[model samples]
Target: MPGGLRHLGEGTAAALARELKEELGLDTDQLPEPPVLRWVQDQTTTRPGSTEPFERLHLIHTLNVPDSIRSRIATTEQDANDTTQVVWVPLAQAAALHLYPAIGSVLTTPAGTSIGPVELPPMVDGTYRWR
Candidate 1:
């Protein structure tokens, strides 16, 4: 689930490796190349302190980590003002949660399926199940 904006002159695989290294403390050799892209989300939102709309492109990739690091991954990550919690829930359980892109169950789709352009309305209830 480690993700970040792609750096200039870097491909997606390299960017993914960078994010995984920075966020999960994993080295490139520990990770396989060419992650499987699961989805591409076209997200639009209003950032804090701004009324104008902001657009972002999300590339969702599925990576399988060895058991060595799967359960040992840090659950909490601290930054300036945000804390990211990592958890591995069953796909069905995760689908039931109110997730952005609403990628319910598609995560279990067979390989080679290109799920893309996932869009949805803003949640007025301010409720989100982020993992």
Candidate 2:
């Protein structure tokens, strides 16, 4: 997924569109509406190899992509500043990977577990720590 905070006065959908184009070279005009906010985690973190502390708000959205677009996406092309690697992991082996917000419960929850939104736990740290 694209990263970076929203620009001044920009809405979520617009920021996502711009970030998609700039970071992943994806076109959002042909895609569906803005994604549903699946989870939000607030964290106090520190940069790698640095002692500075900062607050980070993580927003995970669930966007359904059509098979046509999904098929065209052969691989995730990263931008110069993006360090994330996108790969497909089988649901059975998903736990082996390092994932943030610890989505194990979310993955294991049965379908129709609830009708409305699902909110995950938040992270707080006394000192600087990077995930």
Clash number for each model: 0, 0
Candidate whose lDDT is highest: 1
- Angstrom error at residue 127, model 1: 14
lDDT of 2: 0.62
lDDT of each: 0.63, 0.62
Across residues 1-131, which tens digit of lDDT does each residue of candidate 2 receive?
Answer: 34667999998778877776666666777677656666666777665776776677776555566767766653664565445555655555675444664554465454446665576666555422345
Report residue 92 deviation for candidate 2 (angstroms).
4.6
What digit string (tens of lDDT, one per residue) describes model 1 on residues 13-108?
888877877776666566544466667666666556677766667777777677786766666653213767777787767777656654564655
- TM-score for candidate 1, residues paired by index: 0.69
**Distance from true location, Cα of 127 in model 2, Å:** 12
Give the number of colliding residue pairs in candidate 2. Answer: 0
Per-model TM values vs. the true structure:
0.69, 0.69
Candidate 1: what lDDT? 0.63
Where's the lowest-lDDT run of ten residues in candidate 2?
122-131
